[model samples]
Target: MKAMIFAAGLGTRLKPLTDTMPKALIRVGGKPLLQHVIEKLKGSGFDEIIINIHHFADQIIDFVESNDYFDIRIEFSDERDRLLDTGGGVKKASWFFDDHKPFLIHNVDILSNIDLRSLYKIHELNNSEATLVVSDRPTSRYLLFDDSLQLKGWLNKTNGETKSHFPDINPDNYNKLAFSGIHILNTSILSYMQHFPDKFSIIDFYLSICSKVRVAGYTPVNLKMIDVGKPGSPEEAESLLL
Candidate 1:
């Protein structure tokens, strides 16, 4: 039904490109990164979309208007005055997802081949509060899950640290899944986040209460994906998708 593109980041990693433009405006495969994400969502049958804007916010707004919103319903959640982190950005745009159905949250710079319709279906079938796209990809940090793939803990490989709600949990026994920066969240999750601060990471918030709630991961294999997070990422994404 509806989706929100997380495009408000400063995108410092993209360096010179982001100096004059937001990362969402960076081109990959001859189109802006934001446009790619929007087209993917539209192709997946999600016509109503919301994008948050912060870095060079006006430029993003102007570009969206220029495209006539790519012939779909598009709205902007303004964060020009303050840049809220992932969880806070979603919280700020909670009103847009008032239809009581599950909504998607996708990063602007991520390119993936995951089926959005099927992912949503899985989320519905599981009756979950949220379903994060997890993979066996390597990363500095990972979300840990139990045998049933239930959200259990978090681990930071760089520092050899771990956090688990289960007192008797063993890090050696849990599975590590790299988060794909894509998620489907039920509206009920908003109520659970009422007590959180306005600028916290969604991952942190999830780990804080995963013990009491349902935050499952969807680990699909043979999935082609890429994160256009750095200056040289566009070249790589072109080879993957174009």
Candidate 2:
């Protein structure tokens, strides 16, 4: 199956280093984060992959060209003109997938031991429109799910803002799970998005349709996942990822 890596972000959080290079090219355990993600996807049976580029686009392009895409079919969704956020990035690359197949979307900054094969199986088994990889981790933002693991709404812990797809129920009644930058989306989800211009996060799109769409959460908290977005976690990341 095909997978898309969201690597176009400027990564403001990882400043200094990101000032000159993209976050995907940042060194972690002696390898670029983008390289590690591609290796992981390759291990999980994803051959044809698409990567979005915006910040330091030429550097990434050169790096990939030099390595020959690690013997995998790699394609670029060039966004040097405008860096579309997650939702728009995926929409731009929608033409890469074929009918009767699902695609994987992952973040470049996130390193996870998530089982993509199992995630694809769960998504297919439940016939869900999209399966989001989530965990019961502490975070300011969370996606609320019902007892059946169906997406209910979203909660912002810091601001006390709550958005529910089901207007009748209180958000506090559902389970709040943090999103792990991983998603197994059916290509059909693209049909639902109308004309969203510029940049927009994909989570907003999910929240808009949680009431009617079958968006389920796959809990794999036991999996070792880390967001290497800052310099503080380098020691920890080196131990876990290397």
**Candidate 1 structure quality by residue, lDDT tens digits, 80-130:** 999889999999999999899999999999998899999999999986799
Clashes of 2: 0
Quick one: RMSD of model 2? Answer: 1.4
lDDT of 2 by residue, 120-155 (tens): 888899888999999998899989999999998888
Evaluate residue 124 in candidate 1 and report its C-alpha lDDT on the 0 to 100 scale: 96
Off by over 4 Å in 2: none
Best by lDDT: 1
TM-scores for the candidates:
0.97, 0.95
Model 1 TM-score relative to the real fold: 0.97
Lowest summed lDDT across 10 adjacent residues in model 1 is found at 163-172
TM-score of 2: 0.95
